[model samples]
Target: MNATETFDWAAAGESLAESVTLIAGGARGTGRTAALSLLQLGARVAIVDLDPGRIATVAEDFAEYGTDRVFTAVADCTVREDVQAAAAATAEHFGKLTHCVYSAGAYRAQRPTLDIGADEWDLIVDSNLKGAFLTYQAVIPHLQRAGGGALVSISSLAGRTSSPFLGCHYTAAKAGILGLTRHLAKEFGPSNIRANAVCPGGVVGTRMNDLLSELHREQDLVELAKQTPLGRNVHEPDVVGAILFLLSDLSRFVTGATIDVNGGILTI
Candidate 1:
């Protein structure tokens, strides 16, 4: 794989240019970062988020990338109709949809499974798992009809195994995403739709990473770096690069797979 800094967009445009991609929860964090990267790579993108103001501002900021290429819609991923509307508009805007990236949700307050509240559990699950499921169901038809597309579902390292440090809901939802990806990949492969999950561990600049950022500033970054065989904490761009590969033709033969962008934390 080539470094993103050296990846030539012009060359990619001529060959693997993508017309439309949906970025859920794209107002901030990894979702927004990934959307920006995709835009820079010449993919027409649609930003879907619950926050209308932020969505509008981001769409405007990305105008220079291609006014015709950037789109924004305020939608709650937990709502089916919202996802449907967003999907329909995306299909209409780009003439055809080729990629679907679902990166929506929040991980707040680590609570023990025994102590987790009903509302808290609902909040995380609805946003992470249900939201992804709703968005995928809505956008998949468009991809299937157009012959096929790529899907990159965000999962977390906590999901790979039990974590006393992470909240129960967060890890569970992330694990669920993997199961969803596998099922979708198997069911949709014949239609040419490829689905994969990216499980990230302690992303450096992401919101989740901020939880212990101060304490981990120096000693921890070094320790975390060592935890990963790569000798560096995971970064948004690191995960995004993995994401783009799954979206591009480079992984055409890949599907029903889960890629761990955890800097070699789980080498199994």
Candidate 2:
């Protein structure tokens, strides 16, 4: 109301303290990294993943954050019941849900476009796209109970562009994630909930590396970096940082947006 009024950025960012974040696929890669970052930002975190053993290890590693601040549940993102149970468990454990990140995805070995079978297509789509839908389906009610929250979906640069390395099924599924994320933001904005997607390009430390290893293209990172204007591929922290901004009050006004974490490889 005054021309001399000043905005308090630091005060505005204090919203992360004591908030609760639930991350699907939080046992490894970008998901795990994001969960850890949220802990550092003073948020309690709940990890949902398929492997109980790996979840145990992650929980052990996060012990420094205190057992009371970390929780885990076994869930297959593609399975509706599993996802629902994971969401309910997380909400019950935390008593309030404030943020969510769905980073679970399936990227099988690359095959020729013509050779991709229906089974392969369904597996990838269900895990990447439909899984996002189910996670939102399960988590939104809990998030609403907390008066609104932020949700981020992990997409890929391949989803935004034609991929020379990934299969058609993977590319299509990832692309669908962006569309799905936008719909969530539009539909939930009125409820004070925010949703966005992060599109990472050639991330070096994520499950994408496993795909390269399977294709015997593990050595491509060095060459790929040279093609980027930044002379490097994105690492785990790069994508994690983007997700943190979207999840926190820092991006309170941002929603339905795709934040690219590439090393300047593609700009759109």
Q: Against the true structure, whose lDDT is highest?
A: 2
- Residue-level lDDT of model 2, residues 11-118, one tens digit each, is 557677767888999999899999888888788999999888979999889988886799988899889999889888888887888888999887777669898889
- Per-residue lDDT of 220 in model 1: 59
lDDT of 1 by residue, 145-255 (tens): 888888889887877874434588988899899999999999999998999988887777746457665334445566878767777788899889888888887776789
Candidate 1 stretches greater than 4 Å from native:
1-15, 213-222
Best by TM-score: 2
TM-scores vs. true structure, each candidate:
0.89, 0.95
For all predictions, the C-alpha RMSD in Å is 4.7, 2.0
Quality of model 1 by C-alpha lDDT: 0.83
Which pairs of residues have clashing backbones in candidate 1? none
